[model samples]
Target: MLFVTHVVPVNEPGQPRLDREAVWEGLVMKANNALPFVPAMSECEVVERHGDSSFDRAIRIQGDPYRERITLEAPHRVVFTRLSGPILGTIANEIEGDGDDMQLRFSFALVIAGTPGNSQGEEDYAKNMTGMYIAALEGTLDAMRRIAVDNAA
Candidate 1:
């Protein structure tokens, strides 16, 4: 498994003055049909809302559908475990601290399964995917910040 973590400080102008809980409640929870960060993805189809802590959804990306089971820890983190997809493992978005001191971070602990027997091929694949994933995360942070600010108001 490869674990990658990215953190970005929210310091954009005109940002809303909302705390971690408020951001989680207003923006994160309400974002159901589409993910706030992922680019070039279709709207998600929510399968089940398992109480306040978790939910299940299928999101289509590049014509392929990926399913995940998501769990929320109020005021702080949201964890997504791939239930069915090309990648298997977990992605966690965590908000550290409170108020103006909050920092947003994403930890991606994932593995590309089903590709056994070829160690070199797996290494190449992992390298390529990690680069792509990091690029995607960069694009996502700005959007997430925007959403957090907008909803925080």
Candidate 2:
């Protein structure tokens, strides 16, 4: 098992601030509305949605398609578990407020043992890929912040 965590602060003065619940709502809404925060994600659509807490989506990133099941705990966190794909693991995002703004803390754990061949090399690759994924997510956070600010105007 390999885990990576990254924290991005969603704070900028003059930008409209969303309460915790609103932030969660926005996050779920974004998942349905074209996933603009993730430039690498070419397509995203909800295959199963039952309010904010449970949903399954098929996402295509760089031409590879995969499905993820997300379970949300309002105002604070969402857990994403891969149902089928090249990767196997769970990714979680924990959100909270910082004064008028909020912070998004992402934690990812990849179950490297499930990989085919399951060699040391695969473990190393999973670790490297985890780092890259976290970096991309940080970029997504930046894009989200920009969108939030723009929406406020």
Candidate 3:
């Protein structure tokens, strides 16, 4: 098992304001057709709901479905998931951020289970996951933020 968490604030502050709906629009609706820095999941689509936001779509990555429940507000939050498939389960993303200052923070976790016939030390298993899944996720978030900042500007 490997656990990695990061908090990166947008360098600028007091972004003035952009409602959650607007930010969600940029992320799901507008971002769908746009190139995403997170390559693990692909082809995001958003249904414009006038009220609380939610959506489901196919993630080309590993051929899974990522359903999301959004708390659309200042720091729009999304609890994205992919259930079923060889991956078993994944927290596609649980993210929140302000459209102003282009600020955002993403937290994620990845666990690789040992096979029935395999025996690996806890430290060793964690190390392997950190090298692969954790590293990939970190890189993806970094790229996503950079692109969001550039685009927001």
Candidate 4:
């Protein structure tokens, strides 16, 4: 899998704080719909909320259902596993710790199989994919942080 994680540190040292669950609640459950950080190309809905904050939703990007019933977990760390085509497996989004600050991260892990008939260097593919995924993820988290900061006051 082409595993990649992007982290964006929240600026405030220790302001109004929320637990990991609350953070998950806002970022996953509500932020994608009600909150401003939501991308115009997509929409998100939660079908479940458990101890670890697992939820099911169909991501409609550009009015097309690209993903259905995507399962994202918040156990120990936020992990989103996409169950769809072209994507073998991924831990889409997460938030890690930095004392009082939160480091938002996401991944683009791809499952590739080596073909006997035709061969392609997996390392080169992995490197290209990693760069693209990390850039996009970092931009996403930066946008989210801006939105959160704008509303925090």
Candidate 5:
């Protein structure tokens, strides 16, 4: 299994300031339809809605299909659990801090279907995954900033 966690400041100097509400909205948007935020995801559709707090979505990443159950914890966190995919585990995006010091934390614990745990291949894969996820986090924040600016206009 590969486990990794990364945290990044939400507010960058000179960028459009995003409040908790805006950030929460962006998270929900990404959960529902990731095509705009996740460059690797070519397609996404809501498969089922488990009420206001949870839902299931089908997404295609790099031409492979997968399903994820997404649970939203209001204005704080969004957790994505892989239900059917090459990799199985949970990935969480959490909002931390208050006011101007807000941060976004991304963490995941995943394993390739047939790969042995703690192997060199797994370690290399984990490193690549970490960099991809960090880029995704930055992209998410950039999308949020754009949304904030558009909303404020």
Candidate 6:
């Protein structure tokens, strides 16, 4: 299995400061439709709505289709579990700290289906995936900031 976690400070100098509500709203938006936040995703659709806090989405990333069940823990976290995809595991986006000192954390524990655990190939793949996730986190923060600015307007 491949496990990695990355955390980024949500408040940065000169950028629109995003409060917890704004950040949470951005997360919810991304959970429902990731195309605006995830550059690699070509399509996203909510396939099933479990409730106000959970749903299943079908997404195409780089032209490959995948399904994920998303659970939202309101102003705090969003968890995405792979339902049908090459990789199987959970990805979590979390908000840590409070007020002006908040941070965003992204973590995942995933393994390719049919692949041996801890193999060198899997290690290399994990590294690549980590980079992509890092970029995604940055993009997410950027989008959140944009949302905050738009809402303040």
Candidate 5: count of backbone clashes, pairs at least 3 residues apart or interchain: 0
Local accuracy by lDDT, each model: 0.68, 0.70, 0.43, 0.52, 0.91, 0.90
Instruction: Give candidate 2's TM-score.
Output: 0.75
Best by TM-score: 5
TM-score of the candidate numbered 1? 0.74
Model 1 C-alpha RMSD vs. true structure (Å) is: 3.4
Q: Model 2: clashing residue pairs?
A: none
Q: What stretches of model 3 exceed 4 Å from their correct place? A: 1-3, 12-26, 29-35, 42-52, 62-75, 88-103, 109-153
Please state the error at residue 136 of candidate 4 in Å: 2.9
Which run of 10 residues does model 5 get worst, by summed lDDT? 34-43
Colliding pairs, model 1: none
lDDT of 5 by residue, 93-144 (tens): 9999976899999999998888899998899889988888888888899889
Q: Please provide, for model 1 over 1-153, each residue's C-alpha lDDT reduced to its tens digit, 9 standing for 90 to 100.
A: 666787766444575455555556633643464455566566687899998778998887657678988887776777888898887889877777765677777688777777763477677876776666555555555565666666657
Q: Compute the lDDT for candidate 3.
A: 0.43
lDDT of 3 by residue, 61-119 (tens): 43545443333332355544434333333343323554444444444443344432134
Q: Which stretches of candidate 4 lie over 4 Å from their true place?
A: 6-8, 12-26, 29-69, 72-76, 113-121
Q: Which clashing pairs does model 5 show?
A: none
lDDT measured at residue 92 in model 5 versus the true structure, 0 to 100: 98
TM-scores for all candidates? 0.74, 0.75, 0.46, 0.55, 0.97, 0.96
Candidate 2, run of 10 with poorest lDDT: 25-34
TM-score, prediction 4? 0.55
Q: How many residue pairs clash in each candidate?
A: 0, 0, 0, 1, 0, 0
